[model samples]
Target: MIDRKKIALLICERLLMEQEMLRVNYINTRDSIGFFYIDNLLPVAIATAIAESFPTSSEMKLKKSLKEDKYISAQMDKHSEILEEVLYAFQDPQVVNLIAEICELQDIYPDEKLYAGGLSLMEKNQFLSPHLDNSHDKERQRWRVLNLLYYVTPEWKIEYGGNLEVWPNGLKAPQVTIESKFNRLAVMATHNDSLHSVSKVLVDKNRCCVSNYYFSDEPLKSSDTFHVTSFRGWPQEKIKDLVLRTDNFLRQTLRKFFKKGIVENPHYYKKE
Candidate 1:
């Protein structure tokens, strides 16, 4: 059995070793959407174990819509113990604090409930449209400050297309593609302008990832405002963009009246 404590220790070590480089990368990109990535985040053997242990897509909950087509689950108990262990490893204090230090962020806290954070798998034809993450936690308390994505799909290629896309300059400009390489961990700032998405999977194999988010008592920027997870179509998809814009507006308006949306978002973990 993989111990989360041991895994977290390894994560902390890696982050410490790469702290300087990570800080520089983040500083370079801080003007647009601050972000950085580290390769070989865990030992190859452990990463492979996690990849092999991922549940089949059919076993996870399918979320298919205009915004995305993927499998996600926060019900950690329903999956392999290692999967749960690895997910929470990012939440470990040492690991979280190291990441916060590298990003120059303060007052950051990990989400224990795993709200909108857990395992995600995308198969061929599956994709997530460009969007900004929800501004706050489920309860409207802490500001969602950072997104942590740890990719474990061994040998996953750039050509296979399940990569993380960041529209730093918005949809009008060319976007940057970060390969979903195995054993690689990518962290990005989440703010009103930090629009990002996942490229559609072109291969038939599953592209799996473990995800987590760190929240802070204050927003990343003083001017940032609260908003729901907003989605938009590609630059060329004019009609779809219009429809999604309307959808975003409606959802934002709904949140104005209801603290939580009409129907609860069933994406978070429910401890039993």
Candidate 2:
């Protein structure tokens, strides 16, 4: 069993401590992305144990098109018992309450479907392109509002790559990249403007982190116009960007009629 209360207190302490750290807010009114740096988020002992449990894989499987780039999704239902416990620790009422308090979210709930959850591992040359997440939940009953990413790569340095990048002003400008520090959690609002991606894992080591998305009845913003989760490429990946944009157009267009996009995004849990 996970001690949700202790984890929540720890998170609150970190948030208060980080009030003085560098805070990055979305540049334009376009994106709702924000970054708060948390140091030593998970206890050293717990982080080390979790790191040891990470499977040593030469390569990742099941590449899914997110935005214009490809990613490895974590299937919550299939996770090991320990991993599931650690992941659920983030969903505790206290932890959720702290996140809501820090990000100022209203009526937040854990999406058991986990639209996109699990460990995202990127090795040398592997990269994720900038893109917005789908705006609605799996069933389209609730709206996707926040993205929660917790990094547990111990002793990982900036040179290792796998930094979190936020392109608040669309693809034309330089993106703000934040190091995926160990035992740190990055929570940001996900709206039509929340354009984000993971930089290519530059070093030989694998960059791994746990992820979860939260949903609510209310959208992130009242005036946040309805649009599909859009994606764009780096200034160099022109061809890839064009293809991805077209793909997004088709999905969003279908969403207008289907409400749940063209095909159901099975990023979450499925019934047996």
Maximum-lDDT candidate: 1
Regions of candidate 2 where Cα sits further than 4 Å from its true position: 1-9, 16-32, 58-60, 64-73
lDDT of 1 by residue, 1-272 (tens): 97999999999988888999999999899989999999999989999999989999888999999889999999999999999999999999999888898889877999999999999999999999999999999898999999999999888899999999999999999999999999999999999999999999999989999999999999998989999999999888889889999999999999999999899999998998
44-92 in candidate 2: lDDT tens per residue?
8877777676654433344545442234555544544455566666777
Stretches off by above 4 angstroms in model 1 are: none
lDDT of each: 0.94, 0.69
In terms of lDDT, model 2 sits at 0.69
**Alpha-carbon error at 189 in model 2, in Å?**
1.2
The root-mean-square deviation over C-alpha atoms between each candidate and the true structure, in angstroms, is 0.6, 3.2
